[model samples]
Target: VLVCLILRLSGNVGAAPESALITSLPGFSGAFPSKHYSGYVTIDGKPSPKNLFYYFVSSERNPQLDPVVLWLNGGPGCSSFDGFVYEHGPFNFEVGNSTGTLPVLHLNPYSWSKVSSVIYLDSPAGVGFSYSENTSNYVNGDFQTASDTHTFLLKWFELFPEFVANPFYIAGESYAGIYVPTLASDVALGTKTGAKPIINFKGYMVGNGVSDPKFDGNALVPFAHGMALISDSMFEEAEAACNGNYHEPKDQKCSNILDEIDEALSGLNIYDILEPCFYGSAAKDDERKNTSSLPLSFKQLGATDKPFPVRKRIFGRAWPFHAPVRDGIVPSWPELVKRSGLSVPCMDNTLATIWLNNEAVRKAIHASPEAGEWTLCIDIAYTHDAGSMIKYHLNLTAQGYRALIF
Candidate 1:
C-alpha cells in the first residue's frame, strides 16, 4: 500500500481535512497500515483564537468502524504526549547515547491503536502546543478547562464527522480523574440537547485517578503498611491516633503519626512503590549502582553535579508545572511527586523529548514554529475551584452514562 506522512493542507484553513492533518513522521522507515493526523483545533474561533493541539492515530485493523477513544494525560498541565509516546502510542522514542541528539522512533507492539482510534490532546491553552493569544485564558480554573475541552470535541467532530457514530470513550490518568468525568458530562448534555455534529456519547474510564480527595487519603497509610514499607506497630499507631481520618487527623499525635508514615516512605518513587528512583543517579553508573531500598537523596542522586546521563529535566517556560505546597492529601507530602511535569520514577522520555524537539520532526508533525520547545508538561496557570468531582460523577450516572474508576 502507498504511504504518506505529513499532509500539508492548502485549502480552507478552517476546514478539518486541510488544517490539522499530519502526513509524515520524522523517523519511520516506511509507510505502515495505520493513518496518522496531527494538528490544532481552535476552541476560541477567529480574533484571538485559543488553539488546542492533538495527535490522532487510527486503529491498525479497521479505520472506518472502530471505537474512538480520547486520551488525556493528567497534571492539568502535563502533555498528552505522555500517553501518546510513553504509555500507549504507536511508537516509542529510543533515547541514544544520553546525548541531547534526535532520538529514534520504534514501533510499539502494544500500542492501543491496534484496536481503536485515539486522540491525544494537550489542553487548557497553556499546556503542550495548545496556546491562547489572549494571556488571560491561561489562568482559567477547572470548569473552564472542562468547557474548553467540550468545545474542542464538538469542533473536532465537525472536522472528522465519520467517527461521530463510533463508540466514543474518554479516558485519562491522575488528575484527569476530574477532567474525564467533567468533559464526559458535557458531552452527555450536548447529546441530550441535540448539539451540532451529534456525538454518540458513551462511558469513560479513569486509571489511578484522583476521584475523591478524602477517599484517596484513607488508603495511603494502610497501603504503605500493606506494601511492607511501614511496620505494623506504626500502622496501628497511625490508625489509632488518626482514627481512620488521615486527611485531617483528629489529634496532634495522629498528625505526628501521619508524619512518621511520610518519613517511612520518604524517598521511594511515590509513583511506583517498587521501582528504584532514578533521581539520585547522577551518572550512568550511579543510576545502576543505587538500586537498593534506601531513599537516594537529590545530592546523592547527583543532583548538584549536573545530573545523570539519562532522564534530563526539560526545565523552562514550557514543562515544569508543579502542585501547590498546600495541595491536598494525594499530591502533597510525597516530595517530588508531579513537580514540573516530572515523570513517575521509571518513565523514560529522553527519546520522545529529543525526537519531538528535532526540527524535521517538528515540521513533520506540523508543530507551530512559534510555540516554544516541547516539554513533558507546562507550568499551567490553573486554579482548582471545583474542590471535588463526586457531583460530576453522580451527575453522569444520573444521565445514564456508564463509568469506570480504577
Candidate 2:
C-alpha cells in the first residue's frame, strides 16, 4: 500500500556499544525476542526547536550484524506508523468485529524487522509525535526535511551510538519518492564534506516514483489508456484539449476528460486495483448500505438510455448489472460510488488510525504532548522545490550508489 525506495548499504561500519532497549510492547500475547525502542530525537533546526518521533525495531536474528534501514512513509505529511502497522512493520492491528474500541495488535510473520533492524520515523517536525516548539518550522520543503532528518540520524546515533557504524539505508514511499532521494543526497554530500558521525550511506530501492511532476502527471493518461480504463476518444480529447498536459488542465474539455477518468476508477481500490470494496475497513453497516447514496453525473446519476445487458446466473442466482464491465464502461447503477466505500485487500490504514489515536497507545509509544492526533498522513504547507529527481538519481549513481526499483 506504500511506495518505497530502499537505500541498501554495501558494507559494515564500526561504532561504540550502547544500550537503547525496549522493555515490552502492548498486545503481543508472548515475549518478543527482539528489542524495541520508541522515542523522540530533537533535530538541529531553528537553532534548536524541533523533534522527530521514531519506532526502532532490532532484527530477531542478528541486531549487531544486520544493516539498519530508515523507513519513511511518504505523505509529505503522513505518519510512519502507517508503514509500521500496515506495510512492513513487526506487528499489525488485528481484525475487528466492530470499530467500537482500540484495536489489538498481533505479531507479523513477514515483518522487515525479522531480518534487518529498522527505524520507522515520523518526519518533517509536524508529522506524528514529531513537533516543533516554533510552529514556523511546520512550513517546510524537500531540502529542509532532508536536512533535519539527516541531523536526526546523527543525533539518533548519539542515543544508540552503537549502531552509528552500522550500514545505513534510507527508504521512503510516495512523496518519500521525493523525500528518499533528497535525504540520500544530503547524507551523501554531508559525508563528502566530513559531517560528524559519518553515515555509511548506501543505495536506493524503490518502485517507479514521482520524479518529475510534469512527467508524472502526463504519464497518467497513457497509463490509463494502456490499461483500457479510458476510451480512446477520451484519451485523444485529453491529449488534444490540454495539449498533452493534464496536471492542471486549462481547457474545459480536458478537465471533463480527466473527470471521466476519475469516474471510471472511482469504484476501484486504487492500491489494489483488482478489488471493488464492498465496504471501507472502518465503515459500519449503515455506511455500507449507503454506498448507493453517493451523487453522480446527470446521466449516471439519472436513468440510462442503453438497454441492460442480459443478466448472468451464478449458482442459479440471476445477477443483473454486475460490476466490472470488460469494456471499461461504468459500473452498474448500484455499483456507482466514491472513496468512503472502498477498501484495499490486506490493507486497513483505518485500523492503524483507530489504534494510534488511543490514549494508551500514544503513552506506550512515548508520543509527544504537543502532537494532538495520530493520522495516516499529514497535510502540511510544504514548499515544493524539486520539480524532478532525475538529476538526483544521476548524481547518486555517479557517486557510486546502486539503485533498485521494484
Model 2, 198-279: lDDT tens digits are 7777776664355777677777778778877668887787788778777667867877777777666544433333333332
Candidate 1 lDDT, 344-378, residue by residue in tens:
33334456667778899888888886667887765
Each candidate: how many clashes? 9, 7
- TM-score for each prediction? 0.80, 0.78
Clashing pairs in 2: 3-173, 5-205, 6-205, 7-203, 77-378, 78-377, 78-378
- In model 1, the worst 10-residue window by lDDT is 1-10
What is the lDDT for 320 in model 1? 14
User: Which pairs clash (backbone N, Cα, C closer than 3 Å) in model 1?
Assistant: 5-23, 5-24, 6-23, 6-24, 7-23, 280-301, 282-308, 319-377, 320-340
Global lDDT scores for all candidate models = 0.69, 0.64
* Cα distance off (Å), candidate 2, residue 166: 2.1
Q: Global CA lDDT of candidate 1, please?
A: 0.69
